[model samples]
Target chain A: MDKLRQHIEDITALSDEEYAYIKTFFTAKKVRKGQYLLSEGDDARYEYLVLSGIYKVFYIDEQGREFILQFAKENWWMSDYEAFFREKKATVFIECIDAGEVLVNTLQTREKLATEFHKMEHFYRAKLTNGYIALQQRIKLLLSSTPQERYETFSKMYPDLGQRLPKKIIAEYLGVSRETLSRLYSR
Target chain B: MDKLRQHIEDITALSDEEYAYIKTFFTAKKVRKGQYLLSEGDDARYEYLVLSGIYKVFYIDEQGREFILQFAKENWWMSDYEAFFREKKATVFIECIDAGEVLVNTLQTREKLATEFHKMEHFYRAKLTNGYIALQQRIKLLLSSTPQERYETFSKMYPDLGQRLPKKIIAEYLGVSRETLSRLYSR
Candidate 1:
């Protein structure tokens, strides 16, 4: 897709021929709202590059409580990465929050692309670097930030997401109760 | 050093000539106990690969409370990655808990190595993948796990770290009070 080529180009340039070859590794799929891309116990065979849509990556606990790990939007990548990389069954679920399209590639295809094209490897490495930094910030926020601070930081960092996401889901992501989120909203 | 070469080789094969060139990008440093590799407001230019030693990556909050983000031992990489990647001042601290040696490489050097050698890029990407999964697990623990569950999981995951680290540090890492951690230890 053009979006995929643009995303890759943001990190590394690719020739038209190279882009054509690279595009073959990915297959596009349309997802409807509430559609589950992955769920616990399924083989996490593909990593997705979002073209347009919002999705939630989450896990259900022993008590059936849901914990949202992250939200992926356009140009974002999402999968049960632990499972995907290790060739294991999924321990998480990825559900489409809005109808949209995504390009999916298997780990084998990803590795092949990276190996065949040095630029692709560079692009993936760069993306991973950004992902790693974001995760580090998430850990810091979880460990040190107060609920209000967390809400404010989330709002500031993802103003668009804040406006688009339901308060209930936002509360879950912030690890705050709905009532607390409402109170913060009022303030 | 040999350790660095071996670390890289674990993920991808490299020629002696390649390893020789790769080693030049890294500088070895011996860290004394209680020495700070990085501190808040300092330029976070280099990422360290621990050769031998224990280190804590942490930050002190406005309330003067310390939060441990991660602990690095041999063969592990540590940095104020958010700052290091962004080429900005650090908001976190990395300090030696036990005297050890580290291989330090600047952002420029790291990028150069990755760009010059596709194998190096693959190695870095694999490392980031593992780190990303670990952080995802940490987020899951923080969002859903009880304190006791956290303590048990940490102990199980890093039994050596459980024995090597101070109870206070472990408590901070788990986001539990010292007394609570002690109680968990007793149980």
Candidate 2:
């Protein structure tokens, strides 16, 4: 609860009343390693904020190759974001890479909180802005950065996550082959 | 201005006073085909709302291969969003694909509108949510869809954009070769 409160404050200054109101929406869940948080084609009803452990968001391609989109660690949020926000079917599978605890909230609960509390709405809007900005940076990196540069940069950006995930998972997220990543690392 | 008003209305219901306040922030600009509204390394201080024509938001790789991130048509917004919202240097270029007109608003003006009009903030927040959802969908498509399927789906999703932009441009946006796109289109 302290971490959640701190997370909200780090993004935007939240009043105590606003924080309490926002807190009502979240329910804690413990997920075991290899358990599914969200499956492809499921309705994504909840957004998750990791309290502990690691989770991977990925999809199986036409050739049945798994491509990792992102990994979430403690304090980070994870969801089949499109489906969760747009009321659509999930297009990615969110799996617990390690046994983890997370705070989960449904979209309806979030909207209710936002409507009932102006400060909460402002806080959420700021978080959304940050999320959107971060996504834009990632897209730019994808376009402009070489795989090696991306690996180096990713290491710098999220060293903890980089160390926790397997080499192949990181390789796929960087849009490189495991073989290519190995070669880059060796060099 | 009419299109801009309609665009705002599509996202959120705005009172006349709110609309008038927003109207003061927007300055119109005429863009020629192939001209840039934004470029890499420049500061993105303003958001552009298209009133007429089409624009491509793209980044160039080291090999000088252009990757289109998105296309904006009538009533659509185009900018180096990462820079615009985050106050960072732009990493993408927004190029007009046809002679066009757009409404430009500086970040400062946007902040004022948000402070002075709650409804305006809600309107922008809705717009951000929509963009965030679309980007998430793009990430899902990149992870799950075959190149041919992606091209087909993109055509279905933005038929107007497909018709307006060159096939080569569309291919890059879909992360495929022009030859591969030609092969798929022929089928």
Candidate 3:
């Protein structure tokens, strides 16, 4: 919970009372590696804030092929946001990659917190601004960049994630074949 | 500025005084067809809220091939958001496809408005939330869907955009060849 306090404080200060109230909106959950927090067809009822672990948000296509949408690490937020925001059934799965705990909150809690606290609303807006920029960059890479350029950009942007994630998963994220990834890796 | 007022009021009600102050932060510009609002290497200082007309946000790669990122219509916001938010040089171009008017504001103006008005903050946050979801859906389409599925989903989600945009532009946006797009259209 202290980490949660620090995370919010990084953007805006909160009184002890406010922090206490905000903490109540979130419940702690421990997830082990290979465990799924969310799966397709389930209700995406809660969004998770990573405390100390890694998770991948992804969807499997008709042919059972997986496409990684995002990776959430410590302090990052994860959910099938399109489903979560629209209060729809999940089309994506959030699976734990490393054993750790996360703080989960429902959409009602998120809105209630933001509505009750202006600072919290600002914090959320700031976070969304950064997320929007990241997705824009991702779209640009998807639309324009070559395999080699993509690999280099991904490595530069997420060197820690590169070290932590498996090569196969990294290859999928970069939209490159395993052979191509291996060639790039050797280079 | 009635459109701007209505756009914000759709999310939250604002007092006349608040609207007056808010409108002052934005300046209106009329864009002629084929004119560029932003281009690569230019300073992306302001974000635009479309009043009337159509605009395409895109980039040209090293091979001189164009990739369309998004099309903005009336009431839509368009910018090189990554650059606009970070105060960096634009990496994308925004050009008017059909003559239209837009309200433009700088990051400083946006931050000031949000800081001074809680409702404005909420409005911006709501817009970002929607944009974020749209981008997520786009990533899903790009990563997992077949070309046909992508085209169908796109047509379903944006029937107006589909009708307004040319087949070649739609093909580029969907990452399909012109022949593939034409075949899909005929089907």
Candidate 4:
């Protein structure tokens, strides 16, 4: 709860009462390695804040190839955001790669927090602003960087993630082949 | 001014005074075809709401390949969003592909609006929410869809875009080779 309190403050300064209100929405869960956190076609009932552990968020392509979209570690949030926000079926799979703990909150609970607390909405807006900035930067990186450059940058950005996940998964995230990732690593 | 009023109403219900306050900040501009609305390293001063014409937001890759990140038409907004919000130098480029009309507002103006009018923050929050949802869907599409599927989906999403731009540019936007785009078009 202390960490979650700090996380809420990191977005926008929250009042004690407001923080207490938000606390009611989040429930802590311990997930084991190789456990599935979310699967395709299911309604995304909750979004999770990874308290500890490595989690991969990926989608299966038409040819049944898995494409890793993101990895969430401690302090990071993971969920099929599209499904979670849009009230749609999940389009991605989230699996725990390392045993982890997360604070989970559902859409209804999140909305209630926003409606009941102005500070909460401010926090969410600020978070969405930063998320948009990150997504904008990622789109630029995908457009501008070569696969090797992207791989190098990814390794630098998520130092722990590179070591925790398989090269094949990183390759998919960087839009490259495993052989290409090997060559890049060798270089 | 009438169009601006209509646009605001389309997004959210605003009071007459609030609408007037917003209108005061925006200045309409006509952008000629082939003009660069924004350039790399420039101060991204304004966010433009497109009233007409096509604009491609893109960046040049290491190998000097141009990759299109987004194409904006009527009613869509374009800016080097990172720079506009952070008051930093722009990394992305926004160019007019046709003679364009837009209503432009600067960060300073937006800040004033947010500070003076609480409703403006709510309106901006709503805009950011839609943008967030769209971006999440785009990432999902990028991860799950093939280039051909992307092209088809993009065409469906913006039916007018295919007729407005050259095939090669659209191919770049879809992250496919020109040859592959030609084959997809044939099919």
Which candidate has the highest lDDT of all?
A: 1
- The alpha-carbon lDDT assigned to residue A102 of candidate 3 equals 97
lDDT of 3 by residue, B81-102 (tens): 9888888999899999999799
CA deviation > 4 Å runs, candidate 2:
A143-146
lDDT over C-alpha atoms for residue A70 of model 1: 90
In candidate 2, which residue pairs clash? none
Can you give the TM-score per candidate against the true fold? 0.98, 0.91, 0.95, 0.92
Model 1, docking class: high
Model 4 misplacement above 4 A: B115-118
lDDT of 2 by residue, A1-187 (tens): 5889998788568778767767877999999999999999999998999999889988887688888888888888888877887899997899998997999999898777766655556667777787787776676666557788889988998988787788988998887789999999788
Task: Report, for every candidate in turn, its global Cα lDDT versus the true structure.
Answer: 0.93, 0.82, 0.92, 0.82
Tell me the tens digit of each residue's lDDT in model 1 across A1-187: 4898889999888899999999888999999999999999999999999999999999989988888899999999999999999999999999999899999999999989989989888888889889988988999999999999999999999899999989999998888778999998788
Worst 10 residues of 2 chain B by lDDT: B114-123
RMSD of candidates 1 onward, in order: 1.2, 2.3, 1.7, 2.2
Clash number for each model: 0, 0, 0, 0
lDDT of 1 at B166: 89
Give the per-residue lDDT of model 1 (tens digit) for B66-179.
999999999999999989989899999999999999999999998888888888888899999999999999999999989999998999999999999889999999998899
Tell me each candidate's i-RMS in Å.
0.6, 2.2, 0.8, 2.0
Q: Per-residue error at A162 for model 4, in Å?
A: 1.7
What stretches of model 1 exceed 4 Å from their correct place? none
Write the candidate numbers in order of decreasing DockQ: 1, 3, 4, 2
Tell me, per candidate, how large a share of the native contacts it keeps: 0.85, 0.33, 0.78, 0.42
